[model samples]
Target: MVASKRNRVLAGMMLAIGFAALRSAPAAEVAAVLRAPDFKLSDQYGQSLSIQYPRESACVLIFADQRGSSQVEGWVRPLYSRYQGRVTISGVAELSSVPSALRTMIQGIFKKTIQFPVMLDWTGRVSRQHEYRGKAAAVVIVDPQGLILHRETGKAAVEALERCYEVLDGLVRTEDETPPTAPQDGPAVEQAQRQSRQNGAGGAVRQSDQAKK
Candidate 1:
């Protein structure tokens, strides 16, 4: 009888521990330090992208829809222009009412006008994961490690983007001091071409040696 009672007590303790873990799990925005959550999503080109991908001296900038403002096309476009290849720019549509076609067009417009990577987050999971507050906002300056290095919620003046660039550049300088690792895949776009050449040459070399034999 004593053993059975002890078993019951042990079970109760386990349940309490599990409850505590669930309560302590990180929630976006509320957590004190900004940690980037890894997520997989498709980009404008329908290519799979993940937060784990290594970036060379670049940051991720997210812009979302706001309540009062329809869309600040002019402001965002120039920011894209000035920073073009140096940074990856993405627009997140927070509203449930947004249509797929509209999202695609907006992405296309930015891809052409801004000439940078643009991503669509239909479920707002990315926004929530990043801990973005406010009905609509812009969160600029995510590091290559996917950490939220700097964030500005409201309408960021032209200076905001530039400031983010400075932060990222500083980070790159710091990383340069560290020991080297595997070869960088270079920028996100060039990665595909790099991989293609590697794969094509890799098999051809084996075949050529066989023919020589």
Candidate 2:
């Protein structure tokens, strides 16, 4: 009788543990799904821009301060070479610390240096919203609806780039594949192209090789 009573207690404890785990799992998942905050800021050319989510392709936002800006090219070049059409890549300069008086000079410098549009964050509000790390560049990947799929902060070293690649590989589809029932013209075709590039055909393989070099 004592053995049976002990068995009952053990079973109750196991059930309680299982229930606790189940309760916590969803909270963790919800916490992980951080949605990107939307805002408009002028680019290097002084043209205003904002990330309109639920876009045709996934978006990559690279946030950097003066120190972190040095690492931007290491991440951007390879990523652009391989996933240019597959993803929308943009840069955000964390220039909130710059004095208001020097803003025009800074913008001019950016225009001269960067060929692409880099949204200038004069107020720092966007940087804070995105949790910009001042020490290292923060690479954030957001899906169509602006849900942040992946984020990492550090130098764009090979290993770090590989990790980012892995996240992107999971999110983006290859160029050739298409859904059977979906129409070819609109977002469905775009969605179909967002498949895994590693599993894609020869052209994709060539692009991947080029990115490594």
Candidate 3:
């Protein structure tokens, strides 16, 4: 009879512990700010970057193409120039999105000319997920809170550049702000198509999970 009582007590203790464990289990984190999908990419300088999407500062993510590179570069490059110390501005070179044969020329010659940080998206995963209608030449301007303030097709026009600046004009502080890069308006769409024909960037490059941390 005493052994039976002890067994009952042990069973009751197990039930109580299980109930407590269930109660103490963590809840899923509710985001306080609009967040972008986390991305781990290396810069041209082989520096690893950790991007916590819902960051405190605003950022401009420009996925540039070689054809519309001059125009898009003209626009987003200024953000880095103006807010070098403040904002998270970068031009992610969608190199992997291009033909593997042309990667050398673009990365070696064209991309090398840029003054700003033109990151290498080797797998093309990030660019593909956010590609604008299969067009990789795109730009996304986000606010300090991480809300997408403005976005444009990779080969959008001069007016789109204005919309982008209009969003940033009120929020950021820049001591040496400059104007947009260039104004290649006509045949912009055609140029984008022609450029993409040359670059056959595709497939999800496999990366190890350890790369995340």
Candidate 4:
């Protein structure tokens, strides 16, 4: 009888804990001023870094698992280069399921190919704090005041990222003539086709080239 009573009490406590978690808003949406929490991890070169160190105008934290590396080259790599000094782009690898050596290998591939700072998040503490999910996730765009201007999830479209840069740049512009914030006029569908051929996405390359002429 005592055992049964103890079991009932345990179950009630579990239910209460679950309910509290459910009722709480996720960590990501919580707004705050001052410095964002710092995450320290080993980069590809085996050097340690935190978000607070090496201050820049902006920062991008990309939380990528193994699978997302495939797409990182075609898309993510260019952005890192484009925003190099202006924005510090840091990649965090979700290494829970991966071996340490294999994680290092994956980081090597990215470094050799993209040459950006990619960190390893073995405990997933950073991921959960920033509310990361799935294969590719990112956040942590801080303004000059050290306030986060954009904390987003998932890989947003290239156009969306472009718009973000434009707005941020505009904010710092001192000229009397400021450029109008244009709507998302994406690469013309036909133009993308032509460029895709030149860059070689590996389908209809020659045919697209002939069509472009």
Candidate 5:
């Protein structure tokens, strides 16, 4: 009788452990850090984007809805333009935080206005993972290789965002450091190609002469 009871207790413990494992959600956000919770989403252009924050270079991410979408063009695009290929710019549409009735209407408006990759956080899973307190929006600047450099919530003014931009600029590699790589058709590569062709021709001629002998 004791052996049967022991087995039943063990089985109950196992069942509880399994249930707890199943009920767990993704990890919560790590503040002031670039251990950015990964997310896969589609943008307005139907482009599939997977963000693993703190890439090779700095990146700026905006989590918002229609409330702050309009201002993206004003301040955000300038960041994109200033940084150009130096920094990454992305946005997340926090539709799950919006009212059900207003979701569609807000989505339609931003879809037309936003230029950069605005990922749809449909269930707010991504937002929750990032711990986005529901404000008009939240912005984070991460340095290259993923360190949270700056974070802001609400309508962060252009000047204030620019101050954050300077932080990102300091982290970016200088032009002399990260020059544009030359194409394969550059002078050095073209010279190498010419030499390769000459070597092949010489080898063929030598083979023909030996055959003639």
Candidate 6:
């Protein structure tokens, strides 16, 4: 009789715990969205670049520390090949740990080695604002209005890459499916076709370069 009473009490406790979890689930789901922070920083080439919200195209920011820098190309090359025009991709290097004296040398090295612009975060202000992971590369996808839609940090694993691609694919498809409010003239149509061809050709060149490497 006593054992039966104890089991009943245990069951009641479990039921109450389950009810509490269910009650909290909706609150967790309704958490506020995260927005990307805007900042201006000089690239390796000493060119100024700024990230402003509500941009014309979606943006991808790749953040990496010295250790994580090696993994960046894995994410950048493929992303550039696939979404060059449809998305704006940028690289942010977290360099707060570097000595002040070596900063210029580091910038020069980046300029010589990297074909594209790499924004140098000397004080790590931008990286911290973006919640960058120091141990691995952090890839953030932001919508036109600057809301962070997806974030992946770590080695560019196949599954993570695929998830990023799915988000980009959906965004591009939605944009393509939207009906234009006004009819385009001949030049506009021709320009779009030319851009598409250019993108395809660029992707081919990148793939070939990767194969050669």
TM-score leader: 6
For model 5, the run of ten residues with the poorest summed lDDT:
25-34
- RMSD per candidate (Å) reads 18.8, 13.6, 24.4, 14.6, 17.7, 11.7
Clashes of 5: 1
Per-residue lDDT of candidate 3, residues 1-213 (tens digit): 999999999999999999999986532122234445567787755577755666767777777655546656566556666666677776666666567787666566643675555677777787665543333366776666656656666444556656666666666744235688885666987889777765543212223334564
Per-residue lDDT of 1-213 in model 2, one digit per residue for the tens?
999999999999999999999875421111268888878899989799988876778888999999899989988999999788998999999998899999999999999988999999998889899877587788888877788877777677676677778767766864245778855587776667765443587678789899999
Candidate 4 backbone collisions, by pair: none
Model 4 worst lDDT window (10 residues)? 25-34
Which 10 consecutive positions of candidate 2 have the poorest summed lDDT?
Answer: 23-32
Question: Deviation in angstroms for 9 in model 1?
Answer: 59
Output the better candidate (1/6) by TM-score.
Answer: 6
Each model's TM-score? Answer: 0.49, 0.68, 0.52, 0.53, 0.58, 0.70
- Candidate 6 lDDT over 146-185, as tens digits, reads 8888888777778778888988898877767866689677
Judging by lDDT against the true structure, name the best candidate. 6
Error of 3 at 165 (Å): 2.0
Off by over 4 Å in 4: 1-35, 53-56, 99-114, 170-213
> What's the C-alpha lDDT at position 161 in model 2?
75
lDDT of 6 at 37: 82
TM-score comparison, 1 vs 5, better candidate: 5
Tens digits of lDDT, candidate 4, 63-117: 6666654544443566665665666666777767767667667667756875657
lDDT of each: 0.62, 0.82, 0.63, 0.63, 0.71, 0.87
